[model samples]
Every structure is written in structure tokens, then in C-alpha cells.
Target: MDLDDDILYEDDSGNESSENGDDQFMEMNMEPESSSSQKRDEVDDFQFEILTPDKIVSHMVDCIKEVNAVVEIPATTTRILLNHFRWDKEKLMERYYDGDQDKLFTEAHVISPHRSIVSKPKKTTRQTAAASSAEVTCEICFLSLPSKGLTGLECGHKFCTLCWTEYLTTKIMDEGMGQTISCAAHKCDILVDDATVMSLIRDPRVKLKYQHLITNSFVECNRLMRWCPAPDCGNAVKVAYSDAKPALCSCGHRFCFACGENWHEPVRCVWLKKWIRKCDDDSETSNWIAANTKECPKCRITIEKDGGCNHMICKNQNCKADFCWVCLGPWEPHGSSWYNCNRFDEDDAKKARDNQELSRSMLQRYLFYCNRYMNHMQSLKFEHKLYASIKVKMEEMQQHNMSWIEVQFLHKAVDVLCQCRQTLMFTYVFAFYLKKNNQSIIFEDNQKDLENSTETLSEFLERDITSELLVDIKQKVQDKYRYCESRRKVLLDHVYEGYDKDWWEYIDI
Candidate 1:
């Protein structure tokens, strides 16, 4: 199935457009409508471009040229200056025209192009040849060779071309550095320009790797670009402004442009990150232990019961106090009772029980949200496989005199279904830490409505269609999916409203 064969574009008016492309790209219409009709959904309406590797390189060159037109410096030097400012052309221009130019060049690790030099007698052709022929020892290899064989940067520290190639290769291949590679001379901070590195490195593999590293550095450092985080995907997204909004990659993987995780709606990036850390940690296991075990009253050592008797002894040799495990009180006070703890009614015992109950309750609450989150995630994974089933259904519908265009609604239904599931999955994470209030109750009600509708829509899609009921099934499926989309939007809009009005209150777990 050649799905995602084109890019999706969502304009400011919430309308969509698609173009046929050589590579796989899927456009997503996942943004929810704003609760207030007076305001536009600006979160996902920002300007951006989906760029391939070649396009990325072309764009970088275009930026350099655009800046070079005004600065009128060597393109190589301009590249160095741009890299210093993280590819922010506006910032670089401001600094260039309004600030100290020499300091700018110095901070970029390049010798100033306008530096003053004392006039000297120009050497003739014969004198130049004689000077080039004079042998000088290479500082690195300590080998004497003709001066023509040695080369260096503007800093005047010379090394053999062979040494320079090896040094650059190590920096490029071993250290995986390209944009920030410095001169190989000791304690020198001047950067080696791209032309110099390209000239020195002869290996095609190293050259390609160096080029890749350079492009990667440009994307990573540029505030306006983000590499699509999908596995094995080489595409990048370029935006006019940086914001925490959904970005659909050409690979059909949707992610948050700001944090690079899957596009999670309702739950902001901060809470999602905290929830992920909580899920990955072993703190829950420790909590379980705290609720189920008791400490030795004497040595403070933890103990778990393996026998029926309530009478217990501290295992520590230095302090073996006989105490009833049930109340953690001295056994001597129990007299001859060997099977029961008379001090179970003590204040300490009551407090300990209350603490254990609180720990257990908190653990159960976390699990409630975690299980729902995981269930939806697992369901979403399997939902992708539905495309194969959907293709078969699409074919079946076409064979039954239905036009190919008409059968596309099945595919659209599955897309909407997957998005609804995704949104429902994150609602649990938002609710888990939410402190109870009227606003939270309303959020949960919205969550419940969406969850119920999504499940019903999923079930409707999985039902087999027969020739007799084909027309009826199509109408039902369309209505169900439209309802699901509406509910999903409602849930999201309410959460967004909460964010704007500061209606959310959270409790620390």
C-alpha cells in the first residue's frame, strides 16, 4: 500500500491541500477547533515547509547567499558567522551592522577579513619558486619537505597536507564533528573553513559523512528547523516560528515540533514528560514494598512476614528486641499470648495502618491512569495494521459497483479513528495528577464521552459489510466517525480552554 505518498498542508483557514511527490509524506488534520469561534486555531496554523535532504542543502545555500548579498564577504566566512549565531540571519545582521565587526569575526573563530597588514616587497616568480623549493621540517611528523607541500590556515601554523588530511579525518569520522572543527595546531582556536576541509579530505566516504554531519549541525542548531524524529526518517520540518505544536512528517509520523515526542493533545508537554518519567521509574515498586512490609522496631531493619505468629524478634545481633509485628510493640507487655498482639489498638499501630492505606491508594490511582494510557497506545499500534484490512475492504467495495472515490471514506474513517484514539490516550495522563475541582470534573466527563464514542467508532469500522447492507453501512459509518471527530474536538477544546483560563490544579504524586 503506497500510503503517505503525498504531503499534507493545512492552511490558516483550516483548509487542506495535497501535492503528489516522489517520496512518502502524509499530511495530518489533527488540530482541534478553538472553543471560541472569535479566535483562530493559531497553534497548528503557523507557516512551515517539509524539506527533503537535497532541499535542506539548497535552503542552507540560499540563506548564505541572501546574507552574503548584504555582508559582501566570502561565503565561507559568512557560513562561519552564521553558524556562530545558530543560523539566525536576522540576529547576525543586527550584530553585523550595529556592533563591532572585528569582535564579531573574532568570536566566530575566524580572522577578521579587514585586518590590517604591513606592506612588504612582492616576490617575483623566480623568488616564489625558490621560496617554495626551500625545505622545511613538518612540526607534526618532524619530516623535512619542500615548503610547497605544507599548508595551514590564516593563523600561519603550517603542517603537511598528509597530516592535515589525517587530522581532519579523525575529527570528522572519529569525533563526528564538522561545523566546529578547529585548526590542528596546538592551542589554536581558528576554525577550518568548509572549502579547506573539502580540499584536504580525498576519501568519498569521509567526505559524505562530513557533509551529513554539517547538515545535521545546521538543522540541530537552527531554531527554525527540527529533524522528524520518526525512525529511519531523513526528513526535516522548517517553521517560521518555534512553538509547541503538532508537526506531520513526510514519513506519516506526527510529532510535537518543540519536544519531538508524539503529538499529545490535552496534556501539555511538561506533564507528559513528568508522566513518562514516572512510568519508567521503579518508584512504584518501592511504594508497593513500603505498603506491604514493616520495619523492625529495634534496629529499624525492614521485615516481611513469612510465618503466622505475630510475635517477632529483631534479626540484628546487637539489638534483638522482642516485639509484636502487628503493633510493633514490646512482646513482654503481651504476657503469655504467643499468637496475638494485644497492643494492636495502640496509637502507633493505627497511624501505621493509615499510612499504608494512603500508599496503597496512591499506587492504585497511578495504575488506573497508566493502564488506560498503555491500552490506548497498544490499540493504536494495532490500528495501523487496519490499513491492510482497509485496502481489502476498499477493493471489495470497488468490486461491488462502488466507485474508488466512494470507498475512500473507509480510509478516511480509519484515519479519524486513529487520531481520536491518540487524543483519548493522552487524556488519562492529564487526569492522573489533576486535583479535584469543578473544572477537573468537567474534563473527566468530556474524557468519558470521547472514550465511549471512540470505542464505538472503532467497533463500527471492524464490522464486515455485506452486499445487501452496503449502503446502510456506509451511512452509519460516516455518521459514527463524524460524531467521534466532534467529541474528540470537544474534549481538546475544553482542555485548551482550561489552559487559557488557568482552571487546572495539580497535586504532586
Candidate 2:
């Protein structure tokens, strides 16, 4: 597939509008590709999907299938061989095809019971003898159990089910050694495979834990694979590029495929991580930028804004005074703590918006995204009126009060909500490298207005229905939601217009 397949154009004319930032947007005039062609192109790209439990099992089976096809071995033996190599199919292929077959099998702890005396390798004679033993002592717990109640790895080191259960449970739950748990036999270093571990462990929950650890090891240990860092999201990202760069997961997580951190393109992973920690460390330190740190005018000590209000009262007991959050001026001129001044003047706002070109400081843009992202996220909390509305929608659904999935749009609306928030967050990253010009100015202002309205809407959405201001809040929330969403559309449209029309002369370095 060509780059053009991934990137569509703006318009039929493919023309750039005039210098003025008005009535401009990407047309995306390309004719839609046929479904078959589109699917072919999708396959051409390195595609990744979140594998389900069944899919994971199928993936392992596929590996076994391919390994068997190459080596002509039993699928169970192939599974063990693959696990022994940490699922490195290439190494398994090379070793089995190009290297000594007996060495590979012996190292992997696999022995074919069907092999007769004539077919048995000299190296596997010891394994054959051990498997023929009528009674074996359990290495762990030093207990005598029936041979049928025991399991052994490639090394013929057998352990009773009770001992294996206890060992496996400890490794999975306490030691977190599920991926590296070895045979309990003294001086035996054979790594236990998932099937053997599951067979030995009786508890379904513990077996699941063991399986999860092995599955996670593929992404955790493999160079080409990366697990999404999002909380509770289980996604493995497999990219074609071997270089260190960002990759997006199916779960909406964009992370550095190389470093396993959030996308930080212009900065190195180490510095980015350090910067993130310096800004986000809890218990010891609060996120400086996200928390909006500014010096207290009275105390001259660093303080963070703790509320949505612009009027701030200094927490310093020695210098208890009120001041403006924006300019550090006294709060007295604007009485009743009701004054709004963070809305900077046009000239100051213009300068602040494009300050990235000169200083290359990402502080403002980072803060903007952090605040808006958190605002949208916090708005989704259970206490908010939005959830109440969602509850009503669910009740309507349960009672069959409405037909044709009347509340279906809620899912789409929330999806759009999250999408817009993410676009707003990443737009700043793009803006940080953009030239300070009319385009940047327009986009920045759009962002600022959208953010203001979003916060206002979030505030309104949080208001209790029983409150006297409920009607007013509802009206305000609706108004802000429309305005914010519309502005966001225009902002993204303009950016897409620029990208499609190739508007950038040179990105800011």
C-alpha cells in the first residue's frame, strides 16, 4: 500500500486558501475505496488487535501449527519447544532445522514416548529411563504421591500435585514468578510451561493467573511487542517498525513502542519520563503544571490553584491575603471574590498562545491539555448529572418506554466526547512544533474557547437537580456543549485542512 492509501487529500482542487484563516477545511475529496481493496490495504499495514481469551489460545495453537509444519513434531511437543524458547518461532526454526535436533529436544525437555530403542537418541536415554520409573519421590514437600498424581518437566524432575499446587500458587500470587517458575527439583533448572503448570495447579483462578503471566511475557519480553500502559486495558501492540517511536493501541492508548511510555515524539523517553514524574509525582509532590502552580502575591511562595474560581486566598497563615490567579494582583479591586480575570487581554492572549515559537516552552500547551483532559474525564464521574441522565436512559431502556434504541446516541456521544478530548490533547503536541502564525493563533484561540465552554458545561453538568439553579445549569450546559463541540469541530477541520493542503513552510525547531 502507498502512503496515499493511508492519507487522503483535502479537495478536488487540492488548493490552499488565502492567508486569512476563514472558510477553510479539508474536503477529503477522494472517492471511497472498494471494501475488498480497503481490506487488502489494511492487511498490508502491520495490524494489531486486542486478542480475546479464545484468540490467545488460537494464537498459541497457530504457533504450534506453524512449528509443527516446519519441524514435523507433535503439537504438544511443539508447544513446549515454543514456550522453552520464550515463543521465539525464528530461534525454534533455526535450531530445529539448522542445528542438532537432539540438542533442541533435550534442552526443551521434550521426549517422544513413541520413539523405539532404534529411534531414541543417546542424549534422551536418561529421560526415557526416568519416565519408566514406577515410583518417584516429590522434590517439593518431600511427600510420596502416586505417579499419576505427579507432573514432570523436560528434565524428568517430578513433583506431586499438592507440592506443585503450593509452589505454583506462591509463585503466581506472592513472588510474581509465574513466567520464570522452574522445576522444584533441587539443582534442576528446567522452565515449566503453561500446560504443565495448569495441569499441576488445581484452582481455576490460579491457573488463569498462571496463563495470564505467560501471555503477558510475550509482549513484556519480546522486542517487537508492547502492552498498552492504560489501567485495566489488556492490549498488545505489534508494530512493523523496529525503531524507537510511538504506536497506537486498539484500546486508544498511544505509547512509545520502544520505551513503553506515552507518546513523546520530540523528546527522548528518559527525559519524557523524568518530566512526567516531576510534573505528576503524588504523595511527595503534586503535578506542577496540571495543578497550575503560581507564586502567591502576598507570601511569594509557590502555590497551586485549588478551585475553578480565579479569586485565590493565600494559604500561608503569616501572609493571609487574597490575590488574582492570573496576574498575582490583589483580589480587592474585584470584590466578593466573584471577579474573572484569567481571561487575558487579546494582545497578551495572542502572545501567550504563540509563545512556543520563541521559547519552545510546552508549559502552556501541556497545562491546557491536562486541564481539559481531566475536566472531560472528571465529568464522567458517577456523581455528575450526566450519570443521572444515563441512569434515566437505562431505566427507559429497561421499561421499554422507548423503541429503536432511543438512548443509543449516548454511546456515540460519549465516544465523540472522548475523541474530541484526545484530539484536543494531541493538537497541542502538534502545535508545539508548529510555526507561530495566523494558523496557530486561530487554532489556539479555538482551543481556549472550547476549553472554557467545556469546563463551564462540566460545572453545569455537576449541579444537583434539586438545586434552585438546575434549570439555569441545564440551559448553560446545553449551550456550552453545543458551542464547545462546534468550536472543536472547526479547530480539527482547520488543522486537517492545513495538513491536507501542505500549509507548513517549516515546523518550529
Expressed as tens digits, the lDDT of each residue in 1-509 for candidate 1 is 11112111112223222323211111221222223322123355865667777666656766776797788776677778999999999999999998599889889999887789999999999999999999999999999999999989988989999999999999999999988999988899999987677667766567667777877888999988999999999888988789888887767777888888999987888889999888889989888888778888678888888888887878788888888877777788888776566445678777876777898898889889989999999999988888899899889988899999888889999999899889989999999989999999988898898888889988878878677777888898899899989988888888898899999999777
Instruction: Determine the C-alpha RMSD for candidate 1 after optimal superposition of all C-alphas.
Output: 9.8
Query: What is candidate 1's CA lDDT for residue 187?
Result: 92
Model 1 residue runs over 4 Å out of place are: 1-44, 124-127, 293-358
lDDT of 2 by residue, 1-509 (tens): 11121111112223333422111111111223122311111322534444433344445445555677767754445656777787788987888777467777667665643344556546577766665555766767777665766777756777777777787899898877755676777766666665566445555456556556656665565556566788888656655454555566556666666677765433345544544563465512333332346666566787767788877888788988886766556677656445655543446434533442333334445555456545544644432345547566445444544443554444334444544555555554555456777777877787787666655654554444343443453455455666767877787677767766866443432
| lDDT agreement with native, every candidate | 0.80, 0.56
- Report residue 294 deviation for candidate 1 (angstroms): 5.0
> What are the RMSD figures for all models against the true structure?
9.8, 18.2
The window of 10 residues in a row where model 2 has the poorest summed lDDT is: 20-29
Taking all chains together, each candidate's TM-score versus the true structure is 0.83, 0.48
**Lowest-lDDT window of 10 residues in candidate 1?**
1-10
